[model samples]
Structure formats: structure tokens, C-alpha cells
Target chain A: MHILLVEDDLQLGSAIQRALERLAYTVTWLRDGQSAIAGLADGSADLVLLDLGLPRRDGLEVLREARRQKVATPVIVMTARDSVEARVSGLDAGADDYLVKPFHLDELAARIRSVTRRHHGVAANRLEVGTISMDLATAEVSYRGERLELTRREFALLQALMERAGHIVRREALENSIYGLDTVVGRGALEVLMHSLRRKLGADAVQTVRGFGYMMPREPA
Target chain B: MHILLVEDDLQLGSAIQRALERLAYTVTWLRDGQSAIAGLADGSADLVLLDLGLPRRDGLEVLREARRQKVATPVIVMTARDSVEARVSGLDAGADDYLVKPFHLDELAARIRSVTRRHHGVAANRLEVGTISMDLATAEVSYRGERLELTRREFALLQALMERAGHIVRREALENSIYGLDTVVGRGALEVLMHSLRRKLGADAVQTVRGFGYMMPREPA
Candidate 1:
């Protein structure tokens, strides 16, 4: 997941950045509201962690502008300003969730998961296709009552494919999910990953859409 | 971004999880070596933040198992075992980076960014196509010297399209980038976003590939 973290506190921002990276998230940290708004306009982040008090532009204004411009990425407000009025206003401004300062990290993680899950229309953390079942929360994949041993990249690739089962997944999208978006992947890197996945899961597991991408058939052929 | 955090200490794990979430990372926190191994096997995380003195299975053993299984996700070892020998062994055991428990969070964030960047083969933080230019670091986009305002979703979609300029971006792929893999987006949501983008960037900025997807012509047709 990619996150846009907007905060002015150097100490807090740095700490949050480290913590998020430790949890395996790619974060783009901006210290001011103007940049935060600019960042949102470009759509590089999966979600935004917005702080209300910011330099150049207020966080609330940024949120308002984003909504005005129809930027639909979910936003979760995290600030020291903790009041029912503030929370209501933030939510009214289109913030998907709110977190007060000095809050537990687990709570933030849960809210992030919840908002994102709601955005994706995933009611649960589990996804299943055919005999392949995956628990997003546990990061476990079992095929036909037997667990499948896959590498991190392989598991990520399989999850991406299986999530959209019966629909073709563009190669570019698959590559982005497996590797960070900024990375310049070699031409054959994806093919190599796909080949490995096929070797383990059987050739009929993933279908290529010729010039486009790959798909996990609803009924594996 | 998705992270697999392997740490046995409850307080430390909780702290780390909070910090990461503030930075907008989606973290899967595991307290033991066995669950860490299982998590890695599914390939759900983009990277792993591993601790050596883990309960159940040693952190080093988890790393070794991941490597043996060809789980190539980058692993950053963070532990209190601060010895040259321990660091060397951790590196030898396939750790991409190492940090002491008393290390600065800022330093950890920088190292995580550095390791992930290297893994992704990203040498620079800027991407450009035609008159549209993007600074990946700042998440800024400009067209013909004019700063173009884009929503977070729009920016993501544009980045994906511009990155593969001249190639047809599969609709499925574009949708995945804009919304997320599991999001059951309304049929016209993408069209609406694209329409807005076209209005802002001019109709010629993006081209639909009929039944396939959309493309940004290399020559800007």
C-alpha cells in the first residue's frame, strides 16, 4: 500500500515514516498542506493521513479542495485537535476516519484497514477463487485444503490475480503491485515471476491475455 | 504499502505499528517466527521488518527459510543484538539492512526507503512523458510548464499511463491502479476520472483502445 502522510511535526513525521515502512508500506511524506493538496491532485497515494494544522494551507482546506475537485481517495484525519466538533467537521469535510494524537498504532492500522476495505467493497479480509483460498489478514493461501508454499513476490502476484479472478489483469498493473511503482522493472522480470507461479500452481492457473496481461480463470482450465 | 513486521516484543511491536500507520503503511504485524514464515510464504508483504530474538522460530531462521523457499522480498533486520558478528551473520543470512533496537526512527525510514528503492531499480524520483512531467519524490505534475492539479486517483492513473506512454494500458490495470485490486468500482467510475483528466489535460492527452483499454500516444495524438 502507498500512503501520503501530511504532517508538520518533524519528530512525529519521521517516527511515523519509520513505523509505516517497518510495516511494509511505501510512504510519501509531505510537511505542508500545499504540497499535500498537490500530492492528492496527482493520485500517487492509496490513502492520505492528513493533519489539520499545517503551514501554507490548512489541512481542512486541503481536504475541502480535494473534495471540491472530486479526488475520491480515502482520507483519515490524524491530529492533536481532538474534539467531537472537530471530528464531526473532519468527517463532514470528507475524511473517511479520524484519529487523535497519542493514539495506539494498532487502532490506526485497524481504521486504515477498515476504510480501505470499505473503499474496495471487501466485506472481509478473506478472498477465495476456485479451490484457492487466501486470508488477507493472516496472509495465508491454501489450495484444495493443502497450503501452497510461495515466495513473497509469488504470493503477492497470486493475490493480485486471484482477487480479480475471471477478469484479465494488465501486466503493467501486476508489475506495479509486485514491485514498487517507481522501480524500473526489466522486461522479463514479470515473465519470470509468472513462469515460477505457473510451475508451482500448474500451467492452467493463470491465463495470458496475449498482448495485454494475465487472468485467473473463474474455472481453472 | 504492505509490510510484514516480525517482532516478538509486544510494546515495541505496538509502537512500531502505530508509527508506520501514521506514515500510511498497511502493516501485518506478526509476533512469532512461524507466523512470519507463513506470512512470507503467501507473498502478501512488499518487505519484511524482522527481529532476530523472536519467540517460537528465531528471526534468523525465518530469514533463512524465506531465502530457501525463494521468497525474495527484501528483509530488514531490526534487533537489539548489536554486534559486528551478529550484523554480519544477519547480512549473510539474507538481510538487506540491519538496525539496532535503540536506533533512530529517521535512520530506519531512510534505510527502508533506500533498500526498497534499490530493489525496485529506481535510480531517480522523476518521471516524464511529452509535456507532462512528474516528480515522484514530491508527487508533483506539470504540463507544458503549467502546474496541473490532479486528484490522488488521477495522478496515480496518469502516472501509470505516462510510465507506459505509447502502450495500451489495460482497463483492468488502470482501474486497479486508480482504486485498488479488490475495489469493485462502478463501471463508469474510471470513465468519469478519465473524462475529468481529459478535460484538464486536453482530449488528446489520453486515447481509448476500444475494447482493450487506454493509451497515451508516444507522439501525443
Candidate 2:
């Protein structure tokens, strides 16, 4: 996912940019509110981490103007304003979520999860297919009673399939999700990864639909 | 939704362009494959309608190049070649759907709906909350077995709410969905439209969450 981070604090901004990059998210960090407004209106941001305090303009004003102009990108306000009135005003001004500063990276990740899940029109952080559960908050997967250990590529593959849950997910879509657009991946790399994944679970965990894609049954057979 | 149209036939291209615009879809119409490739790579189109017979480049070549470059936009191939092999090849080259020539406008609309639904990581075209059912193919809504009367804005609003059924869809998000990002809408227009929709569906159909937005129950109250 691509994130637009708006913060002028060098220390906190660098920390967040680094953390998000570590999580494999593409981050574009801007140090002022004017750029933040333009970024939000440009229609590329999957989500925005906005700060209420900024150098050029107020963050609330940026958000308000964006919303008034019908920019619908999900925004999580990360700021030091912890008052109840401030949070209420933030939400009223079209922030999708409000996060007080001095927070842990884990909490930030979890909030990103919840906000994005809702942004995708799913109500909760959990995506379930049969006995396999994907916890978006922790980025964890468990099958039956055991935690399913997966590599980053495997996790991306699983996420792509499980997001659709019970359908034949297109192979091209899976490749784009796992390897990302513009990433050079070798031929048969996906098959090799799928082999390892199926071996980790069972052969029936994901079924290949010949010439089409792959499907995971809503119920494991 | 924004559509990228690639077709060389002036008659068919003009008809489709007009029809899509009438349906409220923004279309960037291209007369050949080279521009289609560039348009697909630009990432603005939500969907692409590609004609297999093109001027400068073969449609399959365009599709193949775009897919090779990892452009993941959903595309429906419109072609006069109706052979099973041609259809299979189109799908293999990453076309999301195939439409043979002499297709009705209704059929084209249905294909667009299905392709877009799957592109959004959803397997089905039906969104049901409570007794209200929204049919993507027909763009129709039925509440309690009775057809609901909705204007375009009202339909857009209902579709937005029903897409995120059972959750409090933010007011700003709803406004963006009902009115396009570049549209100029008056303040309280959403409220006025929502009131009329509720009047038609029933007062209890949608409930407001104060200081937040609106929620429609999974089961009607």
C-alpha cells in the first residue's frame, strides 16, 4: 500500500517513514500542509497519515478543504492534541481515524490495519476462509489451532487469496500483489512459492484452477 | 468510475463513449493500441474496454505488454473474433472479460459490473443488507420485495451505503461517492438526498450516527 505521511517533526516523521517502509509500504513523506493537500487531492494515496500541526497551514484546514472538495482517501490523524474536543473536531472534519502521539509502532500498524480494512468496505480486521484466519491487526495467520509461519512473499500471496476468500483469484492479480508492480520476478517463481506454501499448510489449502488462477474453498474439504 | 476505451471503429467507439458518459462513467477514448498501452500504465482508469482489432497494434499485444509491465487494471476485450481459442488467448493475456461483437448495451453494462466487482476483490455482484438488495448488473435496488425509487444521486448514495453495509459509512465518503470528486455540490445536498431516499424506502431504513455518519442494518430494524 502507498501511504502519504504529513508531518514536520523531523524525529517523529523519520521514525514513522522508516517504520512504514519496514512494513513494505511505500511512503511519501511531506513536511508541510500545502503539499499534503495537493497529495490528498491527486488521487494516488491509498491512505494518509496527517498531522494536525504543520508548517504552512493547519492540518484540520487541509483535511476540511480536501473533504469539501470530495477527496475520499482514508486519513489517520497523528497528532499531539489529546483533548476530547480535539479528537471530536478531527473526526467531524473528516479524519477517518484519530491517533494521539507518543504511540507505539505496533499500535500504529494496528490502526492502519483497522482503518484500511474499513476503507476497503469490510467491517472488521479479520478475514476468514474455512479454518484459516487472517488477523489484519497483527498481520498474523493461524490455521486450525496452530500459527501458520509464512515468509513475506507467502504472506502477500495468502493475503491476496484470502481477501477474496472463496473465489478463483487471477494469477496475474496474485503476481502483482506478491511481487508488486514493476518488480522483476523470474518465471516460475510464483509456482515455486506456491509449492512451499501448500506444503506448509496442506496440498488442498489452495487449489489451482487450470489455465485460470487459484481458489481456496470457503470450507476446507 | 473512469474507463479507458481502446477501439478503432468510429461508429462503435462513438456509441460506446456516448453510452458510458450517459451512464455517468468518465471515459478517455483512444483509437488505437499504442495510446491504450500508455493509458493503462498511467493508472487513472478503473477499467479498460479493449477491442482486439486495432489500428497500430494488435489488441492482444497491447494487453500482453500492459500485463508484462504489471498494469493490473481490469479489461474487457471486445472483438469480432469469436473462436474459443481467441477467447482463451485473451484471458491468458490478462483480459478480465471477453465480449463478442453484436452485444447489447445491457450485456456490456453487466460485463462491466462483473469485471469491476471482481477487481475490487469481491467475488459476487450482490450487496445485501437487511431486506434491501442492490443488483450491480441492473443497477437496481429492491427493498422488502418492492422496487425502490431512487434518483441518480440517491442511487449512488444507497450504493455507497450498501457497499459498506452494516457500518457507519462516513458522511464525507458518502458525499464523494454520490458526487464525483470534481463535482460541485451544495452544502446539505447529501442530507436532502438522504432524506428523500429514506422517505421512499422507509424512515427506519437508514439510521444516522450522530457526529459520525449513517448505518444501514444487515437486518432491517
Candidate 3:
């Protein structure tokens, strides 16, 4: 999971960032709402954690503008104020959930999990592809109840491929999804990852697209 | 991430569920808007892939009702009807991004990444905490400008910690993020992953929370 954390307090921001990452979430940190808006325009976050007290733009205004521009990303508001009216206003402004200061990190993670679940319309935590079944929260991949050991890169690659099964993923995009944006990786890194994935997933699980990309055709039941 | 896939077509739903799993996203397949709404109300998904041609309730109507109920999960609309009117109406009625049928799985993945990025209000692909940095698109992690080599599980665990940075994550959640929800991992799985993570990350990089979980403290400049 990826999260956009918008807050001005350096301490809290660092704290929340660490907490979220430990749970395997990718986080993009922004010190103010304007930066948050700019990040939204760039289009990469899975969820937003917004603090109302910010420099340049207030969290609520950013929320309103994002909705106005038709950015339908989920937003969760964080603030020191816990008034019912504030909560109501935040929700009315399109914030997904609200968190007050001095809140529990567990609660925040739970809320985030709930919001993403609702956003994606997932009713359960397990996902299956062909003969392989993946438990989302546990990161386990199994075929016919037998487990396969996958390297982290292999697992991430598999996850990426599974997310788009039956459709081709361009080499560059696939690379981006696995390595992320800041690291400059080699051209052959994806191929290497794919090779490992293929070995673990069994032959014919993934198909190469020659110069285009790769695809995992839906398995015949 | 968990996804609620709301498509009336059983074949398509099953196929998509497979595809999404390959990408490592957990999916719960629902056949109509009513079930989708129920799933959302139950708050189980990380995001929603909603088909506008849903039975029981229209996709747009579901969206309106979700918003009315202050359900803030992000919704990505999918449809066979690729008309401008459909796209506009979907967005206007509260759907996030609209994907036309026959779209590539890679494109869907990209759209999911894009909307997820937008929703989070952060740059979509990078993970930064204190002096440490990791990029999801490029597969690199650095601390104090020095590159760090991490095993896949270590990298994932570190990425999770970096995402939430200062928060204390519970052991169960940490295990879920690393191993997933359905994999029946042994008691020492987390300890092994954490030990390897600390070894690669250098001494004092990650802190043990004793009974709670682990934490990645911010490094000084």
C-alpha cells in the first residue's frame, strides 16, 4: 500500500511515516497541503493522510480543490480539533476518515485498511490467480495449497503481474512498479525479476510480449 | 492492497480477480451494486473497481449512496460503455477514474497506481524517511547517500517501516504486511525477517518494540 502523508509537524510526520512503512505501506511525505496537491496532480499515491494545520494551504481547501478537479483519491483528515462539527465538515468536504492528534497508530492503520478496502470494493483479504492463491495480509502465495517461496522482488513482480493478469504490462511500467521512482535501475533488472518469477510461478504462468511487455493469461478453470 | 471488484459478469469478475492477484492485490468479487454497497459498508477493501453496468443497484447510484453515507473509500469505475457521457457521469456521480472495457491490465494497473497516488496526496512512487530513502519504481534503498543491499523480505519490511516511520506497528500487522493474511506462517517468521532486516540496515537502524512490534526511527542528518 502507498500513502501520502501531509503534515507540518516534523516530529509527527516522521513518526507516522515510520509507523506506516513498518506495515509495508509506501509513503510520500509532504510538509504542506500545496505540495500534497501537487503530488495529487502528479498521480501516484494510493491514499492520503492530511493534517488540517498546514502551511500554504489548509487540508480542507486542498480536499475541496482536489474534488473540484475531479481527483477522487481517498483522503483521511488528521487534526488537533476533534469537534463533531469539524469531523462533519471534513467528511462533507470529502475526507474519507478523520483522526485526531494523540490518536493510536493501530486505529489509523485499521481505518486506512478499511478505507482502502471500501475504495477497492474488496470483501475479503485473499486474492487468487490461476492455481496460485495469495493472502494479502500475510504475503503468502500458494498453488493447490502448496506454497512457493518467492523472493521479495519476485513477490512484488508477481503481485504487479497478478494485478494486471491477462493484460500486458510494458517493461518500463513494470520496472517502475517494482523499483519505484527514485532508484535508477538497469535495463535488465525486470528481465531478471521476471525470470525468477517464472521459475516460482511455474512455466506458462507469465507470457513475454517480445518488445512490448509481459502478460499472465487467465488460467482455464 | 485489497480490492472490491464489482462486475456483474461472472467470467470477467473471476478473470479480473485473477489478474489483480498476479499484481499482488487482494480482490473480493461482487456481482452487483447492492453487494458492493454492502461490502463498502462493511469496510473491507483497500479500493474498489466498480462496474457501472451493475445489477441490483446502478453503479452511479451506489456511488451517491456511499458518499451520502460518508463512505470515503476510493472508487475506480469500469465499464463496457466507453462513451464520454459515461465517463463524465461516473466521475460526477463519485467514481474516481473511469476505465473502458478492453483496457490493458497494465493500463488498469497504472490507473490504479495513478488514482492511488492522487488519493494519498503524495508522490506515487518514492519512500523517504529521515536520511533513508527507497523508491518503489526503481528498487533502491539508501541511507545517508550510501546504497543498501536488502533481501526481498528485508526490503519489504524496511519499506513498510519507512512508510509509517515513527509509528509502532503491531507484530501481527507487520507479519501480515510481510507474509500476507492467509499464509499460516510460523511464530518465528517475523523475528527472522526482522533480524535480517536489521542486519542489512546497519546497527540501530530498526528498534524492537518488545511485545508490540518494530519501529524505524528517524536518522539525524
Cα RMSD (angstroms) for every candidate in the order listed: 21.2, 16.7, 21.6
lDDT of 1 by residue, B1-221 (tens): 89889988887787677656544579899999999999999998998999999889999899989988989788899878767567656765777777876654444554666667656645555777888888654355799999776766787778778867888878866765555433477879989999999988999899888999999987755
Q: Is candidate 1 or candidate 2 better by lDDT?
A: 2
lDDT score of model 3?
A: 0.74
**B10-99 in candidate 3: lDDT tens per residue?**
866776787677556888998988888899988778799998887789988998898678787888888889575675566656666778
Task: Tell me the tens digit of each residue's lDDT in model 2 across B1-221.
Answer: 99999999887788778766755689899999999989999999999999999988999999999988989787899899867567657765767677888675545766787667544534566878878887653345788898664566777788778866778877766765665443558868988998999998889889999888998887777
Error of 1 at B58 (Å): 56
For residues A1-221, write the lDDT of model 2, one tens digit per residue. Answer: 55788999999999998887666555777788766765564445678999999887899998997776566789999889789988999999999998998899998998898898888886657778888887766667898868988776777778777777666666766765565322546759989999998988799999776544677877888
TM-score order of candidates, top first: 3, 1, 2
For every model shown, the clashing-pair count is: 17, 1, 71
- Local lDDT at A141 for model 2: 83
Report residue B219 deviation for candidate 2 (angstroms). 29
Over 4 Å off, model 2: A1-14, A21-47, A53-62, A65-73, A80-86, A113-127, A135-138, A168-196, A208-214, B1-221
| TM-score to native of every candidate shown | 0.46, 0.44, 0.46
Model 3 chain B lowest lDDT segment of ten: B175-184
Using lDDT as the measure, the top candidate is 2
Which is the winner by lDDT between candidate 1 and candidate 3? 1
